[model samples]
Target: MTKRNEPLAELVTEAGLSEGGLARRVNELGQDEGLQLTYDYTAVYRWVRKGQRPEPPVPSLIAQALSERLGRQVRPSDFGMTDTASLATRALTYNSDVPGTVDTILELGRTELKSRGMQRRRMMTAPFVLAAAAGPSRDWLLSTLDETFDQDAPRKIGMRQIDGIRGMFKIMQEMDVMRGGGHARVTLVEYLSGYVLPLVRRQHDQEAVQLALYEAAAEQAYLVGWMAYDDGQHGLAQRYLIQSLRLASASKNKVLGAHVLAGMSDQANLLGYPEEALALARVGQRGITISDSPACMADLQILEARALAALARDGRPKGSVTEAVRRAEATFQHVRPDNEPEWARFIDPAYLYGEAAHCFRDIADTAQIDRFASESAAEAARQHRARRGALSQAALVSGDLQRNEIERAATRGQTVISLAETVESSRCIETVRDLTKRFKPHGRMPEVQAFQARAGQLLKVA
Candidate 1:
């Protein structure tokens, strides 16, 4: 890799600024975002001469500073730090080829393991861009699966190792459900980087063993993506999920690929992209055999219902929400616990009811909200899943508020807060926040005001 800063030097020269002048400008720009930087000429000199990379937002800030100086649009790539700095940017993209996608995932995993600050990076909920997913979805749809996975090397891997990986993923997933991804997301990424990546990278003689390894690797990637999602890193989660889809396709595992797409769809809907979410859900449905995985089928349909409900909330169409809900219900009836994948084990009646309650709530269907939310709460408690229970209770608060039952809603709101007090889930926190928003019209009342005070205090502590 080249360790030169000729481009930055040229840009600095073109702007007609000395090293001290550039540093002052950069610091002034940093102040706009409440950053107190005391950079001087030496800092600028090292960046332009020694090929040092500026910290994030700083790179963008540098671009902004130069853009203002040059009176034009300048990007970070123009800084001549492409070899090392560009890996992070490239990691977010869904590349067209499998090897390129694998490279992106590997680079991201390595960074996440090496840098605590990167692991702690706040998950920005940027508005969903439809174009971002279009090409990846098309590539997955049109690509042909590999007929054989044979390799010519001495290092042999077998099914036992693959099964061990799968079992570990299941354990990690259980941890995710109970404690949320905040608890173990970083550790899991480290495991993927240190252990799982090498196993898949090794050569194997048997095609079956190789496929199994890739399938296990894909599942691990999907879990990593989900952890990122739960930790609020929406864009990073999408990139990991796209890589999971590519790996699953390489292994000739359509059901697993469909599951990855389902996750992407969920992220899209959660971040407020109903159209793209619904389209991704439909893409998950294509080429999946019904008998192969009933639970996954139900999960995809329910996600489609979720996207439809979101569309209704945006005032696009109302009828599709109900119809989608019905389809989800019908599909869920076929879920055979004995035949389902372990990853989809959580997609039982309680989960479906919780999702349905949100859908009905979105379309302002108070009757369905009452019915589904109540049922979800009942089943969630029976299943010992506090996160879902809290969410359902929050939905009940929404339902009660919709029906003008202020005291009942406030009481349920308190229950959600109590249930979520010990959990580290942003989704649960946001649920309570949404319930608070629903109480805005009745904020003057003492019961609602008391609930508001308690909820705010709890979240502040959390």
Candidate 2:
């Protein structure tokens, strides 16, 4: 047995208190905090003789009791234990009015991105991640309606801010499609830190502010889930995605909420939880229907089709795909919004087409996949080269249709790794790996062989 009568015991002795007396004082303090404690002489004896640690709140109460009795700042550490100082400090430092606190959070996020092997690091205390994940929603829900940008306030934001954020989001999405979430994990975190965090600091109308916060929170949770997904932490990823959904709800942004739900569905499908994926996708579709935006509705429908296809729900998937196509075409027929949210603008006909192709591919519907994939490929070709990752996905589906093993592997592998270099989501790498796995059984294909060799070499160094 370990010795317990150490510094805390010494302190109690110095205070001229019997073991029963110290326990009584500590129990009284616990009552003030509405904590019921069964502590008595035996508990005090256990602390003194066995180094017994009290549960949460009890430690603070003991410290408080000691401080009051001794007339000094008696900390937990003073009792021969390390205090939970970090949590205490975080609680004390949390300030909605202080801009510096926001900067600090951004800086921490940046540091996390820059650290080696950060994406692979599993959080020891899951509650901390859960707490942080819930923060954006809580802030949005409780924020005052009077909060608005000051007209005379300095324009701390600029066009570059918007461009950088949109660019990163696009890049990450492509990387995610091409490789897997694993490869793009770090880039996503960097984007969250450099782009999303700063935008969160900007002053705006209550609605705008909430919307921005929702996007940031969703993106943050996306990255978090992506990392967890890459590392095979399904439960953690699900929790983050759920928290993201709550944040989106708090913002009253139905479209974004649908997007988050779709992402969660994707993760569910990936983990072989097909029923859960279908359920989440249906929820996303309902949310989009309520959103009343044709573009948003189409995007959600496309996501629903993807989930249903994963579950091999033939009729539902086909109907959802048809509806998505019709809705997306209708949305594109109209003039696009001039001041559209950057993330929303990406959810157009091309996006829906690509997603539809993916759904068909999941269900092994080569004919439908080929048709949609070809159309999406043509659209992607016309789009900017920066969107090479998205185009590469279309190329992947088409190459699969043509049975061009070498070209498919080479193109998919190149685009995937290239995207991985820029973004930090491991999902991107996993996507590429999955493609490569499909060709592994047929090892005779020289191009597939070569691509695998190259990828193996890259992994050794990476």
Candidate 3:
């Protein structure tokens, strides 16, 4: 049996309270905070003996209540545990004050970027998820929109701060593509709660502030959806992406909206919902066509082509890939970001080539796939070595065409799988899975079997 005089029990005794008494106090505290706790003396005893921890907001409330009743500060450590800090903890603490939340979130973003994948252990901790689920989205929305900007005293954030946040976003995006959303989801959630939430509270010129808020909200929503996708929570991801689209729409930033829509379309395509993917890509195209931004138009056209390729792969709809390619070629003629977000800085000729290659590969057009795949691979290699994520994507396209050789494709596939384990994106895994599934129907070719085996190994990790 466990010792009765454990830290929590000792603390309870020190306060002149029995296990039942402590549980009652905790319950009362929960009541004050609008939470329902079914905990009892037995629960308290288990926590004391078995190291079970209470959910957050509860832990803080217990501390507050014990301090009030005993006339002494009751630290959670006194009960053999640290304070329950979660993504929602900071957000909830500052929900009544937007500026505080924004400050906390910015600091959090910087911390996340600096640490890279080191902080992933805390991503899906129980308290963090509980708190994130409890976030006051409605309150945040109201507060964000209520503030009008003062043109005379507009607040200016430093470029360094923005860059730090962007860098974090980039890393997370890459991780999500490589590994799927499961590994570092909590980190992304905490990022939104600590960095993006606070920015939403800032006061600025109406137009500028609104634009900033919309972008931030869109990013937050995208991260949330990406996390959900990683966890295989497809329904949740869809909902969050839809919410992100709404936020983008509110800002009237069609470019960002198109990006989010493309993401949604990508998710749909991966889920085998090719028709839905095509429809969403069409929406993005329509939005881009009407906008004055040529670069944004090109990006959307590429996205549309990807969706069209997926539809063609599903054996539905005529001229999908052809139409997509035609539009993409036209957009390529006028691609430049006059005033684009930092997140989209890398969507260049290489990106178009890569996306086009994937589309042709999906349609099983070996010649076109080879042509675009080689060009994309070379372009991606030329840009940055740190883009293991993009390289993995290009490798997937190449793998699709190299289906005849299990040995040749297996080496490259293994490299991608290794890289995929470190990143947080589901797209890479989905691509590999799709490739494997496509080849499975062709019977037991030695090379295909070997590639499938390698893919299976990677899927287990994902």
Candidate 4:
């Protein structure tokens, strides 16, 4: 016999919803994700009275519905439908406590290892929780990072060892650029879980030595997060980025911390939460100063522009978008690669213009897209063509589409396919899929059909 589900029953009541209302709400939310749910009052009764669980997505859909009603970050575990081990559940907290932060990060890496490869994405329809990111972004903004190294335990780690680790990660970063995060993110996780964890555990009498170790670890973790983002495992990336931010904070490395926050902002924008994205980018801007690398500052500024452009497209004024883009371009001119931190050196012209093109696309400003996107694609690393080049080339297709140049857009789309095929990123696949969606209206045309046929073969979307 099943026990009563008091938690679920109480939550429904606290949300001020009747069983029928909750069922209808879940079905509505499911429809947003293309799920045809038949949940009714009896289905809610089975959950509340008989401890019966709904199928995979329905439970998450219920959580999302109640979260909106309650105006808080609700989880399946909150109502006893699942446990805290769930990715969204585990990522919900900022872990302000001392060893709890460390432990939480370790557990997250372990969980990633056990998640049966990239299949973790299949666990949820909407994986990245915007609310989960909000808590940590605010927590880091308010945090003093006063936590000191434990002097009573462990051994000292030298700067040379940290340098060596960075040297190796440089190669991994290159691979991620060329081959996509899917190709190397797991191996990166293996290194973080095995070798880096021990380094993080070691203590030293020299504060400088310890800080270097923390900074190095934070950067490595940030790379893992970046790879995960590139691979399209956004929820997993969000978790890793929070941990990386904490480590950077612990090291008192404000520059790296700002970079991590900027990464968070980019992820948020890409995930369609431009408001949260803008807020995160502002906090990142506030967290650093002019003394920091100009490249890092420029990156944040462009991210802000991207968010503003997204908002503009959603009915906000274009004035803010224009100003933000100007600031980004002006700041990018100040980027001195030799003076920049190794991590920030990637902020080259190609990268800056690539992002600029994206912002212009969001606001439906095709005038600048041709110049910026073409520059981005042309300036792509000559030694190895990668996902960034593919993404930059994609903006051309969008710009062409916005102008009703179906033949030109389809022709350009084949170039995107050629560039995207060199990498294993799901983000690349998703990019073409988005273009294909736009191509649907013009599908009867021979040119449009050609692009659709090619994109369909590459995307293989369900």
Candidate 5:
């Protein structure tokens, strides 16, 4: 059991806030950030009297609340909850050495396994900040290659364990494609903590074996991050992606590192950091070696175009969006499926077209969006990819809205809602929200109202 938080109690006393008062302030802060926190005095009592730590984002929120009440800066360390706060921030560091990177990544997996409270709490529900992403991204961009991964106490392991991890990665990827990331995240974390860590710590002699393991671990970590992003756990997703990037660097896998950066760019764009998103995408594109991996390069270029398109949507600038799209298209033409990495297998023309639809949507090119969305939908249907199909349908809904075809748009909106109901994906939910929010101006219409009501009920259950 943890010790009592006497320092917190003292601070509470000095701030002259009753337990109830502190709880009220914290709840208010959560609500302002769209979090549904219902803490009362009892929660505060536990923190002060029992030393029970609150879940992440909460510790930071509590510190912020106390800072306001005390008319001074109050940090998590001030309350002896530094580790809890740092758990979220630690991944932002690109360790100067390989062992440090490995330790950090392993610890993250262990923490996720041990902290049931943290797993239950939606710590990443808070708003996204570009500032939080800037440092780690810069560190990754400027990082030198790892020289060695010397362990203090090394044990030799073999290809058997590495193969096991690779097999699991394949299974998890298939499951993610079929059932969505929400369904896969819990299982992925379990595998990370239960299998991968133990194997990594075991003995391994061959440098090739070690490199293979590191790359596999990096891919798995990227999957963890990707699933988190799909579940709308943006902060958690960023942390995992950072660790993945660190692992990719340690393995000297520039292609995989580019992939990791692409994921970061995607997350940043979704979280409203369009500028940082674009920068991340460009970083990924620039980091690639021409002879290293053409598939990786094409993927990064597409992601860069995606970021520029998102920025254009947000009214930043439209000129770059078109050029970015053109460049992505041009690069995509060179992807050789037979030579692509396992991770890049999904970056087909259909995927590119679907993303291009988003770019067209951003630029208000309704006709182009319609064409691309149709192509994406047909391909998604052929492949039985529900998530991508829903995304394509989302673009179509927006296009219908742009054409002032309200009834047709509402119909497509309902289809998206129905498709979303079959998947446990936060990305799907966000798509519904975006479409529903656009429907607000026409809410009085029966179709729009019906779609919104159903979508709301679906989200509530999710």
Candidate 6:
């Protein structure tokens, strides 16, 4: 048996909290963040008696409760709790010190130098907490630094390594499109950890070379986060994106930083946080002007529109989805493909249509879904982007399902499944999962069951 008289029990007692009261306070705190915790007096007594630590975010919540009562910062360490991370520190915090940021990323990521004490279990499955990322978002907006990357870490590196990162990243981007982020993510992580970290840690004789290295490393980190998101690992993705934001800041690349924020905004939208999504997209937009990079501007605008649409659905009076959509479309029109950056090259008609289809999907506006989804699929096929083709087909299926066109929806659903099979993409599979759920109302029908069964067989998501 473990020893008794835990620091948690002492802290609770010192705070004058009763067994029932601490349980009640923790449960109430959980509610504010959408967690349906069922803590009670018995659970509290067990914790106090055995010095047992609660699971995951509960430790953070318990500390928060005590902090509120004690009118000071009460960290998990204060009570000997080993929470992986809290709302204010570690992965969630945006480190402004350039050298510290690099070291933090080296430790947090899947590098040889990364600490073995890292517990990825919680990060792999943790829920998206708005409070955890809020500070980073605010910090990113207020950030502007004239940074120096002249490190004296003994090792010497040059532009050849930077070129290799950029070259391989291009191939990786294509692989992500062709075979999903999961297809080659482990190899990519190995490359980032094994090949990239050494370049980052070394001394760069020239300022330009150092900046390029940081920027390339930032892009790789962002891609890692994207891969994690595609695999549905939300917490892991959030932390990587936060680190990527810091890297971009150190590189002095505002546009790249904006792109990083765009990824954060995109993930927030996926995880059901419209307010945070909109906030991130808005911050991303502040860095670049429309005339300078219309495609980049359009990407942020559509992301904002998505957040606005989600808010509209949630009955919040933040902004008009329709107006945001108009702005996105207008800005997209100004996109000169040849002049666009390498990253913004995907902002063509088909890409815009697919994103717009999502906006329409969020609002449940089936009126616009058919046109946008059809155009999106057609454009994706024309451009040879199979992943978007699959997602677009799924959107079409969503519309057909909504219209009660079961035959059409089932056929389209089959198309999505077949296309999804072509790529090892969890996002495409997830889209089909939603299609299956939409079939629930028509469960009495054979076609719906067939589609559901087929999805279960293919995606293992029944």
Query: TM-scores for all candidates?
Result: 0.78, 0.55, 0.59, 0.76, 0.77, 0.75
Task: Name the runs in model 4 displaced over 4 angstroms.
Answer: 1-88, 115-126, 144-158, 381-383
How big is the positional error of residue 365 in model 2, measured in Å on the Cα after superposition?
Answer: 3.1
Compared with the true structure, what per-residue lDDT tens digits does model 3 show for residues 61-111?
A: 656656776797665534544332433244323234333334434433443
lDDT of 5 at 186: 77
TM-score of 4: 0.76
RMSD of each: 8.4, 9.6, 8.8, 10.3, 9.3, 9.6
What is the model-wide C-alpha lDDT for candidate 5? 0.77
What residue runs in model 3 are displaced by over 4 Å at the alpha carbon? Answer: 1-185, 199-207, 227-232, 314-318, 337-339, 383-415, 435-456
- 361-420: candidate 5 lDDT, tens digit per residue: 888899989998999888988988788889999999999998989999999988788778
The candidate scoring highest on lDDT is: 4
Minimum summed lDDT over a 10-residue window in model 5 is located at: 147-156
Clashing pairs in 6: none
Ranking by TM-score: 1, 5, 4, 6, 3, 2
- In the range 101-168, model 4's lDDT, one tens digit per residue, is 55556656665665442334343232677777777777777763333334333222446777787886
Candidate 6 lDDT over residue span 89-156, tens digit each: 47666886766566555545532222123434544555665776677766766664333323332122
Which TM-score value belongs to model 6? Answer: 0.75
Q: What is the lDDT of residue 319 in candidate 2?
A: 58
Q: Give the TM-score (vs. native) of candidate 1.
A: 0.78
- The whole-model lDDT of each prediction reads 0.77, 0.56, 0.59, 0.79, 0.77, 0.77
**lDDT of candidate 2 at residue 441, scale 0 to 100:** 69
Give per-residue lDDT, candidate 6, residue 98: 62
Of 1 and 2, the candidate ahead on TM-score is: 1
* RMSD score of candidate 1 (Å): 8.4
Residue-level lDDT tens digits of model 2 in 95-114: 44434334334433433443
Q: Which residue pairs show collisions in model 4?
A: none
